[model samples]
Target: MSSNSPADPPVRRIDRVLAFMALGIAVLSVLCFFAIMISTAAGMQHADYATGVWPIVAVLPLVGLPIAFLLIVALLIMSIVRRGKAGRS
Candidate 1:
């Protein structure tokens, strides 16, 4: 009967799933970022590159994944929070 509870009707079970998925994406994104960092460091230490472009290309995932992940998480959280608030109202 409360406005904040699931019985509010607007905050569907699907919405909760989506929010958790967003959380998962955020976590996975952070993990991948660390993996890329480690790979980059290993590559640098081993000097196993023939072309100099390997380093540049290898570094792209580090930057791109985190940025995209952050955006996705931000949008997802904002959306879920917005929906939750609207449900309350």
Candidate 2:
């Protein structure tokens, strides 16, 4: 019933952490974006967005998505390096 083969590379903790972090950030960002969209559709004023936590909600997607992209890129690089090393050895 085991699916893993001997040739399969072991998963690293950092990889898992990075992937989860990226996913979580991306999901949260999207949810925030949706919340903004829903609020706007419900007649939220521009002045409201500038106030309090609304600004933070509006900014999260802008900042979070790029960070998630970077995390994904880093994860890819790490996986590639690990695979190359494993293949060579």
Candidate 3:
């Protein structure tokens, strides 16, 4: 007896390639954001110890938010396209 119930599709090679690309982009973005945060913190500490001055608290979102938002939009578009293709089949 053979069982057949429209078995789920295996991961396609293209999907794997795209996944790795997405992962690499995400990791780079995160590392960049972390570096920004660390540098900003170090600057503040240095200012306090030297001149006793801590100016603006605008670093985390300034560089990180836009980069992340753009990536999210890109991923959204990719997913929508993928979904559209799957739907047609």
Candidate 4:
């Protein structure tokens, strides 16, 4: 007897890529923020932030989080549109 269950929808490559990209950016941003916090807790000087990679570390979460958020929104919209199209067909 043939199974009557509907087949699962295939995940698009773009969706996978966007998801991973958002996750990677969010994780990296959080790690950098934590590193900055740890360094400050350890008595890192203000001047030290200007001299090395600290500036980038401090800025990453500020920028990365918003970008990641936008990417997630885009991914969500894409998913909704894809599902709508599939349902219509």
* TM-score per candidate, chains pooled: 0.41, 0.94, 0.45, 0.91
Displacement of residue 45 (Cα, Å) in model 2 is 0.6
Please, what are the lDDT tens digits per residue for candidate 2 over residues 1-89? 45477666899899999999999999999999999999999998899888889988999999999999999999999999998998888
Q: Which of the two, 3 or 4, has more TM-score?
A: 4
lDDT ranking of the models: 2, 4, 1, 3
Model 2, residue 73: C-alpha shift (Å): 0.6
Worst 10 residues of 4 by lDDT: 1-10
Question: Which candidate has the highest lDDT of all?
Answer: 2
Off by over 4 Å in 3: 1-6, 44-89
The TM-score of predicted model 4 comes to 0.91
Instruction: Write the residue-wise lDDT of candidate 1 on 1-89 in tens digits.
Output: 56678634355565576556656655665665666577776665545544665554556555656665666676667666877776788
> Which consecutive 10 residues in model 1 have the weakest lDDT in total?
49-58
- Name the Cα RMSD for model 4: 3.6
In model 2, where do residues sit more than 4 Å from their true spots? 1-3
Report residue 75 deviation for candidate 3 (angstroms).
Answer: 8.0
Cα lDDT tens digits, model 3, 1-89, are: 33433332344566666566656655665765665578776674544533322222234335545665665666667667776776678
Clashes of each: 0, 0, 0, 0
State residue 64's C-alpha deviation in candidate 3, in Å: 9.8
TM-score of 2: 0.94
Itemize residue pairs with steric clashes in candidate 1. none
Tens digit per residue, CA lDDT, model 4, 1-89: 33443533578899999999999999999999999999999998889999778889999999999999999999999999887887888
Model 3 TM-score, all chains together: 0.45
State which candidate, 2 or 3, has the greater TM-score.
2
